[model samples]
Target: MFDRLFFVLGETFTALRRNLGLAFAATGTVAASLYLLGGLFLAYSGISRYADGLSGRFEMRVFLKDGITVPQIKWTAEKIRSFEGVRQVNWIPRDKAWEKYSKENPEIARGLENPFPDSFKVILSDLKKGDEVSERIAKLPATDPDGGVQYLRDEQNLIAQAKDALKVLGGMVGGLLATIAAVLIFNAIRLTVLSRRIEIRIMKLVGASYATVYTPFLLEGAIQGALGGLVAAGLLALTHRTIGEALKSFSALSQLPSLPYNDLTLALSGAGAFYGVVCSAAALYRLQLRYR
Candidate 1:
């Protein structure tokens, strides 16, 4: 049994070497694809924590009209924050709003005067009392003195926007890259099957079982996939250590924790291995029909 395993492994290596160019090509594709996917996964994991925090932190937004006094806004915020279930209140001055807007839309911000209004973000201990809290805020004389108080109807929109942004980016570019990688792997296996038709036919004639005939090829694919995944994982680790650290310094991004190294590596490696096995089995099945 040991000898057969060794023989199969040796043959797998031999096959890889024989098709060294295609093997390397497929490996590179797999590495790039897996790296992109793994990076997305880790990024989403980190961002989800931030998302949860943001969701918890911004249950309500109270927008003040233009020309509202800073003192008045602060007083109003304090009054609302003192209401039942209210935990925290933050004042967003027009300048701060302008700064945030410029950061988000630099092109559109050019030469534009700060027309943004003052606002307050309210976080509550019990979100179910949001309506009651809003009504209490409206009664405060310091809030929206010139007009009726404008309350944000849905605070969940911010979290929803954050989630949608990530999805849009992933679906467009990531989907394309993954498709390219899959096609590259599929072609590599197809080429291998074509190259080994005579050897496979000989084995079949010699009464080799299906597993005996195809096991080496299957393992070859798996080995390549695993190697590619490992390479991607290494790059991911480097990125997290360097660039990810820098991103954490920003106040908005500071909430995201660093990616867990070992878990991400294992996940990527497993995904890569599964990708290889499925593609190899498909290729082999096609060849088997042809040869039979």
Candidate 2:
């Protein structure tokens, strides 16, 4: 049994070697397909992660009512921290806020003469609860001293809208890539079937079982797919490294983390090989039936 298996493998290898040029061409095509698909997946993963990080930093800045004392500000911050969804409350002093603004926009800093209002920067466990937190903060007595705080959850709707828009855009991009991959693989396998029509017919005429003749072509397809996957993975890794180095020079991009090379490679390779084998089997089956 082992010897028979070896013989089948040997035959497949021989056939592949005999058509070295075609095999190389097919491998290149597979590699190119994999590279594009892998790149898209990697970008999707990276962007999704960055968006999550941004979401985690999404906090509500509650401006205090004018003329509030430091003790009242501290009391208000404590109250905010006690809210159900509140994870943390950071009291941004007027001076610190001014400093932050100055650092962020030097031109605006130079013109600023009036001090900005003090605020309680509330970080919530779930951003969706921004409205609830805002309502509670607004009811504080500091807004009227007697009773009537008027804080607004200004960033909540904007954050929710951005997240929804990004989700839709990501899905559309992924779907488009998937469609392109399907079309490319279909054409590749169709060409492979057409090119092997006569060879498959003679095997059927010799009374070969369907499995016996079809398995080798299926195996070849798998091998081709694996080759493509490896090449694509390697290219992706190289591209990622190159891009990361270039991005490091830019202060804004320096903080953004690139995808881990190993994980991305494994995912791309696995998906590429699976696509190859399935397309190969379908192509051979249809071609063999037509020839018979």
Candidate 3:
């Protein structure tokens, strides 16, 4: 077994050396493909974190009608508090609301009556139940008929749509690059097999098993893939560090979550190796040995 392993290793290296240009091309393609995929993963992760952060701060505003009485306001607040997932209900009287509005928009608030409605700022424990909570609050007797319960539903929907679009676009691009890489790997292995056809036939005639004949090519492809993955990982790490440093001066950008570099490296490397082995196997399968 040890001798066969040694032979496989030697043959693998020999073939790689003999087809250096093709091997390089295949490895480079694999690196580029995996790098692109890794970048997408990082970007998606960051966007997801940002979305979660925004969702955590989501608040529903229940606006009371203009002629709403104090008793009606109290009953409305009590009913909202009884709702599932309701965390806190803070009252914002029209006077205080108007004060804040005036401070923020002095020009607009000048010489205008307090147009702000008395409202309840409803905080939720679970963002997923936002729509349910909003619907219940909107049906309350004191809720304003014009604009009753308001939340960041439109903003949330936009974020969700953006995430979905990113996933679709990433999948399409990643798949195309992966297919190109696989084809390059297949062609590289095929060229190596063709170059050593005479030696392969002689080995077959000397009673070499299929495993003995094919193991070297398989290992060669794996090596190429692994090298490519390592290169891509290095590039990703460098980019992450550089961008992180550049964004440090921007407070908002710095708050974005960091990528899991260790996990990403392992995933990329393992995926590349597996992809390479599959492509090599495909090439060998298509070039079935008639000598056997």
Each model's Cα RMSD: 10.0, 6.4, 4.6
- Quickly count the clashes in candidate 3: 0
Off by over 4 Å in 2: 14-30, 55-58, 66-87, 90-118, 124-202, 205-207, 255-258, 288-292
Question: Candidates' TM-scores?
Answer: 0.66, 0.63, 0.78
Candidate 1 lDDT (Cα, 0 to 1): 0.74
Q: Residue 151's C-alpha lDDT in candidate 2?
A: 28
User: Compared with the true structure, what per-residue lDDT tens digits does model 3 show for residues 127-185?
Assistant: 65787888888887889877788899877667777778778878998889888999999
Q: Which is the leading candidate under TM-score?
A: 3
Model 3, residue 147: distance off in Å is 3.2
Ranking by lDDT: 3, 1, 2
Task: Assess each prediction's global lDDT (C-alpha) against the native.
Answer: 0.74, 0.68, 0.85
Cα lDDT, model 3, residue 64: 89
The runs of at least 3 residues in candidate 3 whose Cα sits more than 4 Å from the true structure, single-residue gaps closed, are 65-137
Clashing pairs in 1: none
